[model samples]
Target: MMEDTPSPIDRHITGLTGKARPRICYLATPSGDLPAHLDKFHAAYGDLGCETSHLAFFRQPDARSILVSDFRARLLEQDAIFVGGGNTKSALAVWREWGLDTVLKEAWGSGVLLAGMSAGAMCWFEAGLTDSFWGSAYRPLDCLGLLPGGCAVHYSSDSKRRETLHAAQQTRSIPSSIAIDDFAAVMYVGTSINTVVSWRTGSTAYQTYCKGGTVIETALSAKQISV
Candidate 1:
């Protein structure tokens, strides 16, 4: 969501980079590199005292024109990469086709912080619940597997999210997953949860799974970050 004031989460992310002026990159692939999304990203991050740039897959002379080695080197130079929300399924297909999926893993392994909201966040997991299918109901879409198990975003804002995620688990369609409400984020360091934080009160994340044919939602402790 675009806000007149940057969210505290932005500050938190920047702080994680441990730099006074971090070099941050944006990936708007999921939104097909929509200009509006890119504009908003710059508007938000520009004032944060960091260098900001975006990689676009849908732009003219797109990723295909860039050599994989060069692309990897450019990404490795960044302190962090932030992905914007959009169609997860479509983004993944393009990323794989262009080998961005592997490059992202390399970036993370090299200590570049990986982050995003919605589709961006979901992509790092093994799978995520998505409504990207044009005419069908929400379903589980396999993801990059950078993080173990599955994920569900907008868990509180969208009522159907909880239902679909639980149902998927009940049927063994996805593994035990982390469900994050809007304005909340879960940080992972080396495949384990480092911390959970929320910019909005009452917004948090959950560890959701299926047991005995019933869905279980366990609230994760979240520290509220002041905006």
Candidate 2:
């Protein structure tokens, strides 16, 4: 777990209101660069009244554009910064120069709401088939430790990817882990996470990593299932 200082001005995600925190749109890919499978994210959140925007594939930071310019001010305008899922390696490569990852850490530390699907979520985890442009079919990358232990995005033991992740964990000797099922999202409030409304209209399975790992399929009902 990262030992970070308390954030300064917390971000106020636009739209919904509550001490319960604001809504964060987790796009399955970076803006303008989405995989064929997950393309409806833009309209999905926009229709729900979120001023959704894409930040991946951002050019050099400049106030006139989306990549740079005051990150703090831009963050203040939105309740949360939507993280677009894609190739973690590519994503990290794009921002590795500016240490954008560190910048994001600062934002998170300051209470900026961050929501992401697949890659977006996976990158934040401490480890687990990390940052692979070439489908990591059973191997791991030592990645940023946003969440505890290893985390598997798009988790499902039935699928090859899941099997690969499992194999990698054993092969690499990683620690306790959590895997999220497709069409499902795990929302975070500080260090805590609960199932938020999902997209797949399916079920997301949760798995344990430490001490004889186990997988649990968790189902949760919420006020808003789909917007």
Candidate 3:
């Protein structure tokens, strides 16, 4: 349906999966496993010639007859896993309960493409700022640490996020890390960042770290992506 529109970002993700037709899973656990969140993922990537599935932890128990082990087995089949954005703290809590955290770590080691935005992105790093607790107040939390250091997504869109992350850096609460603007993503190969991509023309990425008791933010070049 969206064949007419070019998808540089999806293409980039697919490439990481190392498959011509990657089997992708949309995980909306961070969004409390919302149905609409999964629907949007299908709308975005369904026409991209990839096999797509959704993992609804909350609804699946009541909606289907399946074992958690069986679900874990299915996850191993995916070539790429795209986690959706929402409450990072809540999502991690549930993921730990179901052992998806270990499964994901295995997937990453086995070369499955792990990608997402905001909360999803933060989960891949050691730590990042999140507003999941206390409403809109951004606080630092230790995360999955798949990648080294921390991350701040929607960098330019949220003012508090920027301020809080900088403060974290200054106080050495978090290590040097990547901060990506809305519509921008940082691609990592293993633990190293490969490139920064943005869907919008003016979007950008930043490298933030503490230096001499001060926070240093260096602007990184961003490549524009289609669709």
Best by lDDT: 1
Candidate 1: list runs displaced more than 4 Å: 61-69
TM-score of each: 0.94, 0.68, 0.91
In model 3, residue pairs whose N, Cα or C atoms come closer than 3 Å (at least 3 residues apart or on different chains), thus clashing, are: none
Highest-TM-score candidate? 1
Please give the lDDT score for candidate 1.
0.88
Which tens-of-lDDT digit does each residue in 1-227 have in candidate 1?
44567799998898899999998888889999898888788777777887887788777534323333467788889999999999999999999998999999999999999999999999999999998886567899999999999999999988888988898999999999999998899999999999999988899999998999999999999998975
* Ten-residue stretch with the least lDDT total in model 3: 60-69
lDDT of 2 by residue, 37-75 (tens): 223544454444555454434333222234344444555
Candidate 2 has an lDDT of 0.52
lDDT of 3 by residue, 1-227 (tens): 11235557777787667777789888888888787666667767777778888777777643322346576777777888888889898889898888889999988998888998778999999997888895767888888889999888888987888899988888888889899887678989999989988877778889998889888899999888674
Global Cα RMSD, each model: 2.4, 8.2, 3.0
Off by over 4 Å in 3: 1-8, 61-67
